[model samples]
Target: MTTPLPIGSTIGILGGGQLGRMLSVAASRLGFRTVIFEPGADCPASHVAQAHIQASYEDAAALRRFAERVDVITYEFENIPTSALDILEALRPIHPNREALRISQDRLTEKTFLSNLGLTTAPFADIPDAAALDGALQTIGTPSILKTRRFGYDGKGQARLSSPREAAQAFSDMNGAPAILEGFVDFSLEVSIIAARSQDGQVSAYDPGENVHEGGILRTTTVPAKIPARLQTDAVLLAAKILNALEYVGVMGVELFVTPTALIVNEIAPRVHNSGHWTQNGCTVDQFEQHIRAVAGWPLGNGERHSDVTMANLIGDDMDRVPALAQDGACALHLYGKAEVKPGRKMGHVNRVTD
Candidate 1:
């Protein structure tokens, strides 16, 4: 896994979502091929990847066929099943490592890892049962969020608690799943640092991007975040610290709460992030390409921004504005080519660049 993947070697991607699609395109730019192994049919990545294996993760024979074709493996998402990963890991090297995925797959585990790293995080406690929920409510208190331990995203599988009385309904919403209670972070804004670590242990980070979310989904990411210079440096340093601690190879998105005091870790995504899409129009080596390079064991590329930019996600109905957006000279559109769009689904993104 130390040697760089030569030109035309195929990379196996574990998901066929938009992130995988974009990663496939990036790998092509570096003369490498990509194969997407996804359970769903007609996935976004399949449209661009050099090859596609449409089979369930539990299908050992299919997973073996996929592992045989690729030089290495990487994933677009963290919720990949452990059984599937165990099968793939024995065949090909998976970048960013299984430890990073293990920590990120659960809210309680991720929060604990960050706290153990000497990083600031919101007060959190594990909730394994209804009794645990009551205890966590007493310990973590009201005005907090109760989130499922795994498989939660875009504000789903979680609930906000204004008072302890709401704990019953919140715990019920989990349907007996493991959960975590997190004390609310009183922050001024949310920012994310998109970072990468090369196979050789070198690290690189992009400027922090201030994020705005609606309905628990990212709406826009504006770079040159409205944070003091010192906090921005702190954000990058903390992201690098996490990367180095994991011996991670590939890109990661570190979301943080910008408080009046120290920056608080909100969450970490061990892959190319929605916020970093601004790099598409603002930097020479965007996050996608940077990720492809790292996982391929090549030298990481420059991530310094050349222009201030704003990246806005095109949710379900947002696709209607494509015609008008396409005519706009300052913005560049990157559509996912999804066959159907449901409410809250990320259909595409547009990056508006400015000097």
Candidate 2:
């Protein structure tokens, strides 16, 4: 196993979203310096990182410089360009590795990988063309969803179909890109497991948190998910299986659908997840800290929960509630430093911890 990067070492981060912002905060707590590489100025992560690389992901010269300056690298999100990774990997080590990124970037590849590991997922098929869509619809059935093969997140690039006529419009919405048609799952509730794996392959997972979404965007997460204990255990086991399957060496979030008879894999985020934000106040070690430990080769910390917590996302205009939420007892408010409150945008979140 590779030795952990010691305290005071610089860690490179690939995205500048809220996830990167939280990772920077956690890394600082462990005495590590962080450098953020992103194209946009005034990104949320740029506010907390030690330094910022204000350049595009495809800027090879800048990427090389970033790789030279950092001891190790990790990303906050999965949508990073593959070519950018090639340049960074040549100069520095990237945790979770490129294979994990490639598999998770495409919906069909992720579903196939999970199925190969003996995990249950929604019935799905590749949609290569309009003709293929007809066959896929016949097999996967209607009242399903058609998702683009790549770059889809936060309910984007997905279309719902209640009938055959809707399939063509859905395909057109995706601009005939590589896509997958997935049957809708009849689930009782949705939950997610936040898990970490060390470089030596040691793995640990946190309790699944129940999730509720608004307009397809996550709105709230509550710990001690109301579900059978066996299903909860299954969630953790499924997350471990995914981490092990990818030989992943960082924090990963696995979203699952708990049904009457079984558990079905929904989607996997190969990094710290928004749903796991409750961990910041609820657990002994938050997902962000665990991610830092795994990528830095440090010993993973205890993930025990000390409190019952509920996390509410401050999306768009919800940021206006910060003043009132901050006044509440036991609530920790986190603002992402985003300038705009555009519809559907995530501005921040608040966690209420109850002992």
- On TM-score, the candidate that comes out on top is 1
Report the C-alpha lDDT of model 2 over 230-329, residue by residue, as the tens digit.
9988888888888988899999989999899999999998999999999999988899999999999998989988899999999888887888887898
Following a full C-alpha superposition, what root-mean-square deviation does model 2 have from the true structure? 1.0
Model 2 TM-score on a 0 to 1 scale: 0.98
Q: For each candidate, what is the lDDT?
A: 0.94, 0.91
Which one is best on lDDT? 1
Tens-digit lDDT track for model 1 on 259-350? 99999999999999999999998889999999999999999998899999999999999999999999999999999989998888999999
TM-score, every prediction: 0.98, 0.98
For residue 198, give model 2's deviation from the true position in Å.
Answer: 0.8
| Candidate 1 clashing pairs, residues 3+ apart or interchain | none
